[model samples]
Target chain A: MKILVVEDEKQIADFVKKGLTEQGFLVELCDHGDEAMERILDQPYDAIVLDIMLPGRDGLSILKQFRKKGHTTPVILLTARSELDERIEGLNTGADDYLTKPFYVEELTARLHAVLRRSSDEQMSLLQAGDVSVNVLTREVKRRGESVRLTAREFSLLEYLMRSPGRVYTRTQILEHVWGYDFDPNTNLVDVHIQRLRKKVSPDKENPVIETIRGVGYRVCKDGAE
Target chain B: MTPRSFRTRVLLVSVAVSGLVLLGFAWWSWQLLEAFSSLSGLDTELVAGHAWLASHLDAVRWFRREFLFLFALGLVCVLGGSWLLAWYAVRPVDLLIDAAEGITAQDLERRIPQRGAGDEFGRLIDVFNDMLERLEVSFNHATRFSADAAHELKTPLTILQGQLDQALQEAPDGSPLQQNLGRLLEEVQRLKVIIRRLLLLSLADAGRIRVALTPMRLDELLGQVIEDVEILAPELRVIQELEEDAWVDADEALLQQAIQNLVNNAIKYNIDGGKIRFQLFRHEENLRFAIANTSEGIPEEDRRQVFRRFYRADPAHSRKVDGVGLGLSLAREIVRAHQGKLWLADAPEGWVMFVMELPEGAGDGAVESGE
Candidate 1:
């Protein structure tokens, strides 16, 4: 997969590029907005990570111009302005995903994959990590070829973690993605839900499919375990 | 008293004093004229002969008619002149009221037109303009400070968070170093939350929160909030008395945040096994929302101050609750920004009830979405 990261801040651009490259994806970095626009029009990339604040043209206008010319590449907006109205504006301007600044690279990668999968025509509805397989369309989960009963929220949470296995998500990220942006930030809801999900999915907690990153968040095991 | 009331009193007193002075002068002139005629002995001269007496009677009748006409004219002139003077004196005050009424939060820089120097109204305008200047300066400072602080703090925090994430990734699984890094990351996350909330409040204080108003089903929003609340506090029993199709014109995201904050507070402050009753209904021209929870109600003295910034009922901060004390303040601000009123209502059964009343149909003709 080819990805273009357009950010004015050199540190962030370099960090994002290094992280994505280490993940085995071909990543290119562009620090200027105009250069990014020219490069985007000149090449075909699978996904684009655009920042809102740039030297010349802003991220919103660039996205607007890209969409006007009928580019369908998945774009994720990176912004420091966490205002709700600004996020809506970004989405309305043909952004496939929105990530506020001070975000985890893993979260960004997860959102990237999610947006790409949504845009691709050959997207599969079934997500499999280990013996647990989730069918997104039907909201069904199966473990070891047997059905598992999960609530609506549990299904959503499992689906989010399964999208990118072996990547850690923070509690805040999980809450924002699964529970929504309005969920209280101070609650232990994530831990409670995770415990419930584990009990339902793995009756014997000795060999759990989901692994906790200590103070971070939960992630699905990369190795498929039975 | 307000400058407006003071000016009104001055006008009234001036009119009364001028009217009394005019009446006194008229009475004195009438007495003087009668005394002068009596001292000139015209009455005795006329009574000396019959012909003289007859002429004197006719002359007396003519003088009486003229004097009555002149007195009536003088009274009309005095009243009219005083009324005009009072109106002239109060004209500046009326202008000031008009100007003040037109000033809104968004237009705080607007000033009243000043009169000439060395006059009362002129001095008033000067003082008002001086106050406005100070306000504008302080408001700008606060707005700028928050924006700059947010920008500065977020950049370093982002860098720190990124560096920590990178280090955690490289560390072997189950390592002691990884555990310490995780703890550090949690602290950073907590700081991030504080900074985010602070920025939110500052923006709200600056009146810079942009709301995208849309017509949405209030019941549906409430249902979603309840679902979220259940996940957060599963022990609390939530009863919903939502009216069907209670549509409201509001900024969906902002209103959702406000309602979520209230529910979160209820769950956070409630005792174990307490119940939360969520009710929604329309009252006249307002859409009313009442969220009542079975908790120890706030003290009567502290009820008014609960919406103040960083005002916790538990001043000692002994409650193990995890909040920076910005929720209620932010909620009230959001409500006020929406032209709504949010207050703590007296609950009959010792429950803490928060009632929000928002004017209906405010979002008419508003753009449904942002571009």
Candidate 2:
């Protein structure tokens, strides 16, 4: 995937470029807001990471301009402003997703894939990691050719993890995506649900597919190893 | 004393003085007329005769009519003059009232225009303008502080979190460094939450938080919130008695935040396996929402303080809960911004209920949805 990251802060921009490049994505960086807009108008990229505070032009106006020209490239907003109205404004202005600063890079990649997947014409009706597969249209889960029953939340959580196998998701990210907005960050709700999902999908403890990234969040094993 | 009463007293005194003057003039005129008739040299016996008596009575009637006309004219003049004086005296106060009505949280720079120096109205205007100046300064200071604090704390925190994430990614799996980094990241996340909430509170205090109101279905919003609670705490039993098509003109996101905060609190502070009852219905001109949960009820004294920032009821019990005690305060602030009222309602048995009342007719113009 080709991605453009427009951030004024060089260090943060370098970090993001390096991370996305390491994730097997073709990454390009632009710092100035006007140049970024020119690049976006000039080229077609899979996704763009646009920062809100920029010289020449701010992120919101650029976004407005991009949408005004009818560019449909998926854009994720990077904002340092934690105000609720700003977030709402970003989303309302045709942003595919938004991440407040001090966010995890893994979260950025996951959101990128989610947005790209959402915008792509050929939607992956089924998400699979090894023997575990979930049918998106039918809301069905199967493990090793055997049917598995999951709750509504469990299904959504599994679907999210399976969408990007081996990618780490912070508890906050998972809670925001699976649960609705305004969840208590201190609750053990995510852990408990992940535990339930693990039990239901992988009854054999010795060969579990879901790997718990200690001190981080949960992830689906890339190889589905025992 | 009130200015109104003072004006009333002045009017009464004016009327009494005018009446006394009129009575004195009537008495003097009566004496003069008696002497004038004696000077006319009419015989006492002739004056007592029927024709003379009729003429004398006619003259007295004419005098009485002239006296009554003069007295009425004097009374009207006195009353009208007093009324005009009262109105003029209260003109400054009326101006002050108009100025006060225009002052709101959004516009604290408004001041009562000072007339001049040394007089009562002038002094009042000076004091009022001084107070407004101080208020505007403090309000600006607070607003700037919140914005600055958010910027100062969030930027560095973001950098710290990003660096920590990068370090964790490079560290070997299950290594001591990774574990330590994880702990640090958790602390960062917690700090981020605290910072975000603090910013929200400060914005609310400064009245800088803007609410974009739209018509929304209250029932649907409640259902979504309840569903979230169930997902988060599936063990707890939740019952919803939502009124059909309950609508409100609200900032949907903010209102949802408040409702979600209340539901989350009910779940967190609830007894193990406690039941939560959610109800919503229109009460007269208000749309009311009530959420009750089984818990060790808060004492009446603490209930008043619960809505205060950072005031936790039963701190020991709340130690296990995951908030900084701003949820209720923020919730109340949001409701207040919407011109609504939030209160702790009386509950039955061991249940503690919180009720929110939003004024009706706000959603009257909103498009109605069948579902």
Q: Each candidate: what lDDT?
A: 0.79, 0.80
TM-score of every model? 0.79, 0.78
**Which residue pairs show collisions in model 2?**
A102-B158
Residues B1-371, model 1: lDDT tens digits:
87667666766776688778878877887786566456445665545555654556656546545876877787788767766777778888888888989876577899998767679889998998898889988888877788778767876787788888788777766577776776687777767766777777787776777666678878878887787778777889999998877777778767877887788778877878999999999899888999999987788898888888777878565233335677788888888877899999989766999998887663435446434
For candidate 1, give the lDDT of residue B6. 68
DockQ of 1: 0.32
Q: What digit string (tens of lDDT, one per residue) describes model 2 on residues B202-221?
A: 77776766676778889888
Which whole-number lDDT from 0 to 100 does residue A154 have in model 1?
89
lDDT at residue A32 of model 1 (Cα atoms): 89
How much is B139 displaced in model 2, in angstroms? 0.8
Candidate 1, residue B252: how far the Cα is off, in Å: 5.3
**Clash number by candidate, in order:** 0, 1
RMSD of each: 5.6, 6.2
Cα displacement (Å) at residue B36, model 1: 12
